[model samples]
Target: LEAINLRERKIIPAIKKGETVVLDFSHAITATHSFLTALLADPIKILGLKSYKQIKIIGANETIRTIIDF
Candidate 1:
């Protein structure tokens, strides 16, 4: 959770600065709902859906992609 929070802190600032943030999940096999939420919740809440425009996700498998989409 602390690590997730630290990543979120970095991500949010980059987004705010209008930089494109790429989240590469290339070798990750899966992710828990709670983990995803912890990583994304604050950015969504603070920046709204517009945050999606600044963030890019790549290399997630089907299941992980589905979870993120959901």
Candidate 2:
């Protein structure tokens, strides 16, 4: 959760500045729903849903992709 908060602080501003954030999930085995939500939910709230169109998550397997899609 602390990590998520740190990233949110960094990422939200980058997105607000119209920077693209690419999150590569290649090495990650899995993520909890809470972790995923904490990492993204606030950014989505602040940036608006349209901002999500600019963010990218690569190398997500089916399970991670499914979680991300939600």
Candidate 3:
């Protein structure tokens, strides 16, 4: 699809150092930005994302974490 194509052709290049991008709506999911963000969290920190932002849902919302860790 277009998302896969964009990653193969475009977005990958922009994921380098000192990069700041805003993922909105369609591109957010299509680019699999959340997964990519989680995958690249350490690198992004090393590359210098002053504040590391990871999503945290409290209480009974730990299902995704369980799913991911499992």
Against the true structure, whose TM-score is highest?
1
What is the TM-score (0 to 1) of candidate 2? 0.84
State each model's CA lDDT, in order.
Answer: 0.81, 0.79, 0.40
Per-residue lDDT of candidate 3, residues 5-29 (tens digit): 5444444445553344443333221
**TM-score on alpha carbons, each prediction:** 0.86, 0.84, 0.31
lDDT of 1 by residue, 4-67 (tens): 7755678888988888888888999998887877667668787888887887889999988988
Question: Which sequence of candidate numbers ranks them by TM-score, best first?
Answer: 1, 2, 3
Best-to-worst ranking by lDDT: 1, 2, 3
- Residue 40 lDDT in model 2? 73
The reply for model 3, stretches above 4 Å from the true place, is 26-70
Instruction: Give every collision pair in model 1.
Output: none
lDDT of 3 at 17: 37
Q: Which lDDT tens digits does candidate 2 get at residues 1-70?
A: 7647756677777888888888888998888787878777767886799778767889888898889788
